[model samples]
Target: MGELRLMKGNEALAEAAIRAGVDGYFGYPITPQSEVIEYLMSEKPHERTGMVVLQAESEVASINMLYGGGGTGKKVMTSSSSPGISLMQEGLSYLAGAEIPCVVANVVRGGPGLGDIQPAQSDYFQSVKGGGHGDYRLFVIAPASVQEMSDFVPLAFDVAFKYRIPSLIVSDGLIGQMMEKVELFDPIPRLTDEEVIARYPWATNGKPKGKERRILTSLDLDPHKMERHNWALQEKYKLIEENETRFELIGCDDAEYIIVAYGSSSRIAQKSIQLARKKGIKVGLLRLITLWPFPKKPIEEFVKNGIKGFLTVEMSAGQMIEDVKLVVEGRAKVEHFGRYGGVIHSPEEVLEALEQKLIGG
Candidate 1:
């Protein structure tokens, strides 16, 4: 453990990446997250730890660089905002198809097409529901606080390499720009080439003695072979769903209504929960940590345990509400409240929506 420092979220993420012993970082400049690369560049992790940092020509080039580095079993990552992330989708799909392990952070902003650089959760669907083509999923982690922004980078890389899948840190402009006290960790040593080889034998680092050369690709001309690959991916996802679903339950044990949220919305919802509690309304919060391996069973359990209804808060036009409804079925009422296009709802507004939609209704 190192001394606690008040740091911005994007800077914290960069510092943590260096401490986590990431092998490389490639990305273009994007608002609300430019500090990630800026910090890395300023710190010069290459001098300190042999890490490589490069500003790519575009998001497309950045993601491809990630593919090249990840295919070689090096810990690599990139960070971008909404539109910038969209540019990387094709590469992401290819990475998923090829089963490359890497981390991508999306500091979300208002969006439909190059929307404003303000905090928004509008990218919820794109982040969790596969923005690219093909039946693939990114292990999505929504970090609400600046502390979590620092913590989730290494966690994302760990899980990504463990499962050999691409992982996403789904954040918002609010979290990215906000500053908070964070306890930094000591630096971890980067893996040696021999260690990389032992850990990821399938990596295309080099053909070792008596070992076949590994081909890294997503293309399969044979339909049967592609189907088999898809099947394997499906199995991996199943295991992830079973073992990786993560969430935080607050005051749900004795509540009549539940609010579902993630990322910055979760922080707002937490304040709303306090307001509701002060008024003697039994409101609780279910904050999602992992968005893709959505905590479905927990939500289902809440419904089964006789919770009255759910109000899903987001910065989008009710994207995650679909997942909540899918899990709740018709057993309980589910409603949505959002503030989109660079707008954010206050705690008072969220509480009012909860009272009107779930309680008063």
Candidate 2:
């Protein structure tokens, strides 16, 4: 094990960014997630790792800052809640279209519109289906534990740089506020200006002599050129889908029914699985790790093996269920169960839903 400590999810994530060698953090404080910026401010990473931490005037400014900095091959990121994230959609879209490397964390709160400062997974559709206006999808990760919240920052940055894609870590108030033990990774070295340019030739850092001209923009006046650019993006997304689809299977081999969930809901489902198994119900858990490049292949495999049904559990009324439906394609009986208004469901509630919605429905 490396460095280990007990910490809140938001603080762990903040520290992980420092160790991940992040160049900068530009964000406005929002509930639950505000702790991320607060921790960074308290730590003063400027003194520690030469990391620049700035409290942007607004979410709009924060994302635009990312647009500017990320285009230069810098590892910059931000965190926000539901309403705050909504304000950054246009900038997020621009970054996606330009294929800039960056990370975003959404410690979600209740919302269709500033609902509350409680944990919620209501942003599933907004996250997976592309929150911003466009046909682009973020490289999305859903952390089920404080450990994951700590670890995925580096992973997101690595993936972002590798593919020149923006990554979104889909966390929530539960994971953000909860405290747990996390083993932190050793610090990575930040890239120098020359190293960044050497590694990422597409970056428009400066007009360096004897180097290729690099233009970073999401604009195209000619429709035909734009069509080609869109096609190229679609091909890249397909490639990511092939290589980066991530999920987990637990107690699934002999299971007759399965519970599909991600992030916080997956943690609750593990207990539900235990309760179900004790009652002689053969239920298993399917945990989604990557939300965008969804692990469709695993679900398809389970369905082919003739699993009776699947129950998609979430804090939202019903968002991820649509994806489950799309993946199962009506072959298996799939239903949704959840609590709305920032209320988290209990294990008993999940077990009950499995019986009523999947097992016996």
Candidate 3:
């Protein structure tokens, strides 16, 4: 354990990856995630801890490199923003199909085109709802602050390896560029080559000792096999939903209205909660950390607690609100508030929305 130091979110992410003992890093630079690669470059973890860090030619190649590294059972990761991540979708789909365990960070920017370099949560669907083509789910973790950026990286790695599935940390420019105090930890133990080989005898390489060549793939031409594979994937997703839901509760335990937010939007919502509290509005908040699993249980619990309505805030065109509505299941009215294409929702704006939608007439 160590004391917290002020560091930008991207730098914190890099430090966390290094501390998490990632074996390899393959990424193409994109704002605001570029600092992550820069930190890895300047830190030169390969020289220090024998980690491999490589800036690839493009996002496509970078994700493919991740596939190569992760296929070998080494703890590997990559980072990119929306456009770059979009390019990596093919590889991400492939990785998911093969059930390869790895970490990916998307410091999201405004999107659909070049978008903007500023903060945006437009990638919520891309992350939580599977950006790539597949009947698969990526374990998506959303971090509202730099603290979560540092903390979630190691957690993502742990979850990926445990499930042998891909895990993603979906952050944004606000968290990535902002500086905050972070408590650093010592590097976790890196898996030795022999150890990885032992665990992934099926990883693409020469045959393991006394074992035949193992092929890692997601394609099954046979209908029966494909159905079985899909069924298995569904089962895995259920396990994830049950064991992986994560959220932070504020005043929902005894409130009439709940605010559902995640990522940077959640940060704004927190301030709004305090402001609402001072005005005697019995407002509470549920900040989602794991966006993919969607933290449905907590929202359901709020509904059970007699919460009447929710304000779903984001930096996108109301993508997450749909998920909230699904979970609310008619027990609570859910409304959306957002600013898209690089515009962020400020605390004042959220407070206004709360007043108009949930807090006032």
lDDT winner: 1
The order by descending lDDT is 1, 2, 3
My TM-score estimates for the predictions, one after another, are 0.99, 0.99, 0.97
1-361 in candidate 2: lDDT tens per residue?
Answer: 8888999999999999999999999999999799999999999999999999999999999999999999998899999999999998899899999999999999999988989999999999888888788779799999999999989999999889888899999999999999999999999988898898789888888988886688999999999999999999999999999988899999998998989999999999999999999999999999999998989998999989999999999999999999889989999899999987789999999999999877677
Local accuracy of candidate 1 as per-residue lDDT tens digits, 179-251: 9999887788999988999899879998888877799999999999999999999999999999888999999
Model 3 lDDT tens row, 1-361: 6867999999999999988999999988888889999999999998877888999999999899989889888889999999999998888889998989999999999987899999999888888788789898999999888888999998998889877789999999999999988988777878887777777665775675787777789888998998898899899989998999899887776678888898889889989888988988888888988998888888888888778789999999889998989988887788888888998887888888988977564
Stretches off by above 4 angstroms in model 3 are none
Model 1 clashing-pair count:
0
Better structure of 1 and 3 per TM-score:
1
lDDT of each: 0.93, 0.92, 0.88
Error of 3 at 149 (Å): 1.0
